[model samples]
Target: MKISPLRSVRVTRYVTPLREGGSLPAIVEADDGFLYVQKFRGAGQGPKALIAELIGGELARFLGLRIPEIVFSDLDPALSRLEPDEEIQDLLRASGGLNLGVHYLSGSSTFDPVVNDVDALTASRVVWLDCLITNVDRTARNTNLLIWNRELWLIDHGASLYFHHSWENWEEQSVRPFAQVKDHVLLPYASRLEEVDAEYRALLTPEVFRELADLVPDEWLDDPASQRDVYAKFLTSRLAHSSVFVNAALYARNALV
Candidate 1:
């Protein structure tokens, strides 16, 4: 259950924006001489998006899934001075503090289910994780998966854990069935939902939930530590209601049977 703490890096140079989404994620070079897909804390989605990315990415690693390395990236406010684009400059100015960095995958291709084949177990686990976290963004149109070195890797988890948007009554919604699971891109390939439930469920212990939740930076959250406790409680509740999500996924995939 033990894992290394997230590494921190300073952005050395500004790169092109991905521009595919509203958050305006960018490809940047860091002090470590590595490229990172930077999620700005100043983006319209706010720090909560980065928080979701950290929590979801770490939890995936704990479950032995292939996720890009996440880091607490430092963005220098003065870097904005070099950007001529007013839009990006504003972004840099707003996000002059801590941002989220996803290790850039070089020579990777977007995963298109139409032409690619994914094994059942891998597909099932991915689908189950999405459902468990109430991540509704991994649909056919936006798989949020990449094929790097001929291996499937998950990315863009900023939309998961939607309940965190409203800390008010978040606990009550934690146990609710993750309905968007029906539209999951992998559901058709995930034929072993029940098996996935039995095997993967236990891996996410209460301790793991708390541990992963604690990974979020204190500054990003309004009440800092209180948010971590809330996240832990919500995740632990979701784990306890694992069956509800598992069954819902199975029922949604029943069309294949």
Candidate 2:
């Protein structure tokens, strides 16, 4: 939970852009010989993106996916500081990193969707996980899925877990009910749903949740009353509907029989 200060990091001469989203993501090699650096473009939406990165990455790991190492980075904003909007700067400063480092993934790119698409089985599980976390990022258009080195890798969690009360709900909305997720992409992986739920429930301990909450900057949690109110609502909603999600996912996995 406690991340040490990064004294230094190595970068390879070779670095390339990975996507065309609001954030200009790239893959680069680190001094540690690690490939891929998912840098934050200060110009991108701002605090929300950073929170998305944290929540999505954490949940992905909790779901037992093979995610890469993620760390908070400090970058010189001038290199790619966020937009010049005053409101945006406040969000950028609140977020520890708006420039500097990049996210690391293993491969170059996935060439074929049919052959390279993440297996339906895995995708199904991913979908269910997304649903439980109330993520809205994974769409047919921006799957944010990459197939590198002949394996499926998920990136750009910045859009998921939107239901998280990490920041003011600029969109101010309630989480969608779990029972309503039958149409989710992970519907196909429903067969493994219950198991996934058990795994998820196990991971949402108070300590872990608090640690995650801590990682989020205080500025983001400025509206203490709204934040607490929203957190309670979101958490309660998740637990209340968790059974449906669990049962449906398990039934898909045949755990119900």
Candidate 3:
């Protein structure tokens, strides 16, 4: 369905602080009256986290995965005046501008692979996406996979593309074997990784890579088009040799079995 990027929505109210997180993300209601798990720019990770969320989530949706809709949410500084908590107050004030939000799943539960097994295709597609993006967060302890109405939805991709954290010479790092794949929650179940790799290689052409990388806001990159070009180059390079990671996954699964 070609889900696009950066649909802007103003945050109307902050329902509560998800204090569990160090960065102080929250459940907020937007002007559209839909609840979102918004990531604030004031947090330590700042826009980099939102940048990952947007690019990663959008790519997943494009590849036929059920990811929550992400939006550019505007936060009004005055709205934080109502909250008495000092820490949250500081965070709200710091995040008075545009923050990122992932549409909340109202009645969802964390995916427990042991209780509910994932089918081979879905598992393979997810593993493929995670490896391509270099997302290291989707491990057994923090699967970051959710199930709503018995359907799986991916969330919390703020950790993908960790190479961008230090872009000193990113090109050299992009195609490095995604060392963390061994811990991926879906790796063992993704027995069809090679089959999905062939299918996705055709879909994730250079045009698609540019389309997704361009979605990153210019402010996030010193040279928007140049960085986009880099992003495309890095991703296409990985996709070109995707079998390296697929082969690694096959070896991992074989060892486990």
Best by lDDT: 1
lDDT of 2 by residue, 44-120 (tens): 66555656666556556655675555665444333225345554344344433433343565444733344454555
Give the per-residue Cα lDDT of candidate 2 at 111.
32
Give the winner by lDDT: 1 or 2. 1
Better of 2 and 3 by TM-score: 3
Residue-level error in angstroms, candidate 1, position 56: 0.3
Any idea what lDDT model 2 has?
0.53
Q: Where is the poorest 10-residue window by lDDT in model 1?
A: 200-209
> Candidate 1 or 3, higher TM-score?
1
Q: Candidate 1 regions off by >4 Å?
A: none
Give candidate 3's TM-score: 0.95
Q: Backbone collision count in every prediction?
A: 0, 14, 0
Better of 2 and 3 by lDDT: 3
lDDT of 3 at 9: 97
Cα RMSD for candidates in order: 1.0, 6.3, 1.5
lDDT over C-alpha atoms for residue 90 of model 2 = 44
